[model samples]
Each structure stands twice: as C-alpha cells, then as structure tokens.
Target: MPDTASDTTTGYQVLARRYRSKTFGEVVGQESIAETLERAIDRGRTAHAYLFCGTRGVGKTSMARIFAQALNVTDEQAEEVAVGDAILRGEDMDVVEIDGASNNGVQDARDLIANASIRPARSPFKIYIIDEVHMLSNAAFNALLKTMEEPPSHVKFILCTTEPHKVLPTIQSRCQRFDFRPISVARIAEHLTAVLGSESIEADEAVVLRVARLANGSMRDGLSILERVVAAADGRLDAALLERVLGVPPEDIVKDVASAIGAGDPAATLRAMATLLAEGLAPERALDGIAERFRLLLAARVCGDDPALLGTGSEESAALVEESSAFEAEQLVHMIALCDAAGGRVRVSASPRAILDAAVTRMALSERFARAASLLAGDVTVSSGATSKKKSLKVADSTRPTPPARPASPPVIESAPEAAPE
Candidate 1:
C-alpha cells in the first residue's frame, strides 16, 4: 500500500507541501522571525508591510501564509477550520497570494492597487502575499509604491524574495524586513528525524544525517530528499540504498582521495579520483566532495572531532580526526582554496575532466610548496626525511658573478701586503 501519510483520496501530495509549516511554532530554523511576528500579532503592532528574505526552500513563503492567517483569523473563528484552511490555501477572499514572477507587469500592480482599496469581505484586514517580489518589473514596483506607502488601514502586504538585493531600495524601505538564516545541519538532522518518525519510516541515523547534509540548510529540501528516498525504500532504507539512489560518491571514495592527497601521492590521488568518476559521479560533484572532505579535515584539525562542527557520524568524525593528522591546518586551507578556484573554472572550462585532474594533482603536490614556503620564511628547520639532520636552504643569485680561482693564490700575497702596511 502507498504511504497514507503522503497519499490522500484527492491525490498524492509531496512531502514538501504536505509537511509544510502550518503554524508559527512549526516553522524550523526561523524561530526568531516566527517569535517576532507572533508578538506583533499579539500586541497589535503588525506592520503595514513585511519583507521576508531568504534562500530557496527556507520558511519565507510558509511564514507569509501563517502570518496572513494570524492577521485575518480571530480567536473565535480560529476554531472554524474552514476559515484558517482557506487562508492557508490562499483561497480566502481577504487574503491574496500573487506570484510576482508571472504577473510582474504594470497592469498587475495597478490591479493590485485597485483591489487594495476594497475592505475585507469577512476578516478584519485584507492581506497581499507577493512571492518572489524581486521578479516584479520596475514599472510594476513603481505603480505599487504609492499604495504601499499609504495603503488603507485594512490592507497589509507581505513580500517574500530569495534575492532581496534585486529588490529596489525604495520598496525595501517601505516594509519591515526580516532576514532568515540558513538552517544548521544539526537542526536539519533533528527535524528529519522527527519527519521520519511521523511517516513511520525507520531510517538509520547515518542515512538521516546524510540526507540532512545533502539538504544544505533547507528544511523543505530535506523533506523532499527524504520523500524521494522513502518512495524507493520499499520499507527498507539504509546507507547502501541511499548511495545507489542518490548516486552520491561513497564515503570511502572521498576518504581515499583525501588520504592520497594528504600523503602527497599524485598518482594515488588521480587513481582514486578516476574510481569516483567511473562510478558515474560528475566532475563538479567529485570536486565538491573532495573540497568538503578537506573542509572536514580542516575543522577536525582546528576543533578536534566535535560532531557539531564536522557534521558527520562518530565513525566518520574519528576517521577525519585521524586523516587530519597527516596535514597541517595551513595545508588543508590551501587545498580547500585550490578546490574552490578549480570549482569555478571547471564549470566553464572546455575540458572539465582535465581541470579536475589538475586540481587533484595540485592538491597532492601542495606539500612541496608548503615546505618551500616554510624554508623561505625560516620559520622552522625542514628535513628531506632521508637524513637525520635538518636541511639548509641556500639561495643563489644568478645576476651576481661567481668569484673565480683568485682565492686559491690570494692568501700568500694578501698576508705580505697587510704586514708591510702595518
């Protein structure tokens, strides 16, 4: 049987929509913003306009809907499920939800302004929730400015955008802006655990944590990933299933590449990288994995094996701590920087494989450069490892002429001249 949690008589609703935040308390990772809005409603200090800005899959749109429901639904009517449901579904007469991307013309703004003057049909206030507001055209924004500045007392506006910098400063100034931060990995993991429990899905802790890391700080994204895995699990979800389904590089492959780089073995590094590519991993993804591995190593070097900082399971953390011992913090930083630069180039390069290979090789050879730098800086004695004593570095100047065989015969004549002068 299909999972009843996601399937309904009407149809199947994706987990992102099915498990969306319905109340202020349900919103994850944006607790501060939720609290502020709730207080605003309780104190009757709600602003005429509110700007919710954050990355995709965060709680911006969800919060917008919840805030609208709070503004229009009274304590007595709150018990009436239909009223709250209609507003949440954007079907209420007093609450309007507009997609700024599609209807971003001047006429749309004029129509919105025209509708703003109408009082609420049943609720106390009429609220406009415009999503992706940054996508609205300049003329459309201009048309709404006057109304936004001096709208009727019964009208309220909630604007949400992933790219707030694209929004005009004038429009931004008219609204009370709230910035939503990316959810942390720990928070995402905890939320995913709860979601799995509710769905009656038994997922390994490692699998859940991997999904959370893959979500990259978006709760909605975390649900979507979990939903996909659950659909294919057939009531069984494990690390192996996740690897096959997601096609993500296995942890061992990434560890091998990291260990090779740390050992300064370019051949081994390339071999490990080839294995990853042979597994059908994209070059960009391979680079990302390598970079993330180095990041974990760096974190381990600096912070030890703290799970919170490393964002890995206990075994993975222990492995990272062990591997990080092979490299200094500075070497890891340089390796990460190399990966970052190569990441940008690989996207636009004609031969992305070559770029990735070059990055891997450079990372493997990074130790030589680090040693050279240390020797030049005279920070510490460097050894070639073949000798028991430290090796001294002597810099030769090519522009300066070498002293000829004059020193072989100069001592006898120089002593006689010095004695005569005295």
Candidate 2:
C-alpha cells in the first residue's frame, strides 16, 4: 500500500494557500495595477518581458502568475473555475515557475534560453515566471540578456523581485516594470474580516485590526496570522487572546506608558514599564508596543486625526487624538526617534531593560524641555509634572530690570542745540 500518511491530497490547506488569488479580480490592495494590467490584456498590449517588484508577500509572484494565466488562458478557460485553479496550481504546462535564487548559474540561463525557443506544450503562449530574479548571477544575467531583450514571439517572461534595483539596469531596461505597493492596513483588515466570515469564525474587529497592523502590509502574513489566531481560538478570537498569542502587551499598557510620557513623569513612566515587566512582558515587547503607539500618534498628528489613516477604532482614534495634543509635532518626532533607537539597541544590548528604561526616561525629559521652552516663551502652560506644591519649575521669569531707563535720552535739549549749530 502507498504511504497514505505522507499524502498531501488529504492534508490541511493553509489559509494563505487556500485563499491565494486565482483571478485578477481576487487580488487585494493592488486595484490600480490590476486594472492597468487588465486594460493591457484587453488591448493586447502585453509586453514581451515584464518586471514585477515590491516588498515580500505583497503579491509580486502571485501577480506574475495571474499575468501568465491571462496570457495563456483560453476564452473557454476564462469563465471556468477549474481552469483558473489549474493555472494557480502550476499544473498547466505552458506556465512554468522558476526559482531564480536556486537556478542562478550561467548554465541555467542557457537552459532557459533553449527552453524559450521551444513552442508551448499545450497553450498558445509559453510563459516563464522567475521569482527573486535579482539573485541570478551576473554571468547568468549576461547570458539571458539577448534573449530577454528579444525573445520568440510566443514566449513571455515575467520577472519578480523584491529588490528590483539589484537587477542589472540593462535587463530592467528591456522589460516593462510594474511596482507592487505595500497593502494598506485598512485593506488588509477588510480582507481579514471577509476571511473570518468565510471561515465561519467569529473574531472581534479589534483582533482583526491588530492582526492587520501586525502583518505590516503583507496579505500573506495577515492570512497566516489569521490562521494562527483561529487555530488557537477554538472559535472566538478576541483582542486579549490576540495579544497573548502575539506576545504583545495590552493596549492599556501602551496607552498608560504613552500618557505617562506625555505627562512628563519619569516616575510614572518607569513605574508603568516596571508593571509590564512584572507581568512577564519582555522589554522588547514593551518597546515594540510603545513604538507602535507613537507611530499612530505621529500619524494622527500629521494626518489630521483621520481614523482611517491611523488604522484605529473610534475609541482608539479618540485616544490617539487626545494623546496627540499632549506633545508638539517635534516632540512626537523626537520620542519616536528615541524609541526607535532604543529598539535597535535592545535587540543587541546586553541589558534590554536598561535600554528601554532609559528610552522612556529620555522621552519624559524631552517633554520637560518642551514644557520649559514654553514657559520661557511666556506661555504659563506647563506640564502637570512641572506643577508641584513641593517643588516648582521656575521659568525664565519673563521679567527684566528695565535696563536703567537709558539715562533719560541724554538730555534732548543739548542734542537740539548741536543740531542747530550743524
């Protein structure tokens, strides 16, 4: 008997794999590029060689496959779901997927060139999809240049890369390039919401939003996160479970620390951080949460308090807007920098707690400086921390001794007499 346990036919399909876009219409967060490509297909203006480039998991490879499908897909197959599935599964002989990072030698390029010359096994057009195309050796690129520049009329090349700049300029010049942008947090959340509904799994909107933000603009990553959360939830996924699963602190923890920093209270800030540590939150976790919070606050400061732009719920948006008022734009920028630097240091530093503490304290001190500046400028408004019955911050006083009254203008009568003589 065959090894049934090892068979993939009965294996579980990951959400990312199950929901991979089979048609252009199913693609998310790249509507403009999809529309442009659709128009090109309609007009029969498809380029011989195409370059698709973007950050990881942003659908560079998927779009390449879709383009290939569109090129070779028959009019009959256009409306057939099985045909589309076959194309996505790479079961169609005409569409070949090549990993450029592995087959990066000159010999591989030569083999590709030879293969390009051959006619399609079944479909009208022979398509080659090479992913991470930048990893190909210089010699391989040189060998492929001539054919890439002028290939057989029936042959199509779709080059996908995360770092397009690494590809040789000559090769890039020979192809029509389309840049895939990072999907926005909102689009990812919207897709995740639909995904949860499709799975019949109930998830709090906050959980979905958190997952979207955590994915950092990668649909594949968002789906993966959703899959993990669903697997762990047993049915219902909420913000608490999501945070626990992600090793992130609670929203209130971050908000408290932010409010403390805004209040210019080092003691309160450190106290909040200590509470987080005592609760088993790692220093890096705290730092990441704080950094993310500052990012939203900064966005709110710059983006006119739009909840969509901040990618937050109504309550969170209100909190962000309120927190945004606690600091000047420059102060937010400075705090973000401090948190970022601390984050970098904590990754390698021997004492992450020390670094995090210092970072939070530095932010609090910065607020104090801003408050002192305002006080010096005759703005009596100071930070709450600055006003203490036990201790007071004496500003520049805004009072000068009147400069001795300028000696009464040195007797204007004598000056008038001198003017008459002159």
| Candidate No. with top TM-score | 1
Superposition TM-score, candidate 2 onto the true structure: 0.84
lDDT of 1: 0.87
lDDT of 2 by residue, 1-422 (tens): 11222334767777887777867888897888899899999999989999999988888878887877777767655445555556788777778889999999999999999988899865778999999999999999999999988899999899999999899999999999999899999999998888777777798877888889999899999999888777788668988888777777888888889999988899999998888777688787788788888888888877766878888787778778878888778878888788788888999999988889989998988845655776677565533554633223343543545455445555555444455564
Over 4 Å off in model 1, which ranges? 1-7, 76-79, 371-422
Instruction: Please report how far candidate 2 places residue 221 from its true position, in Å.
Output: 1.0
The Cα local distance difference test for each model comes to 0.87, 0.82
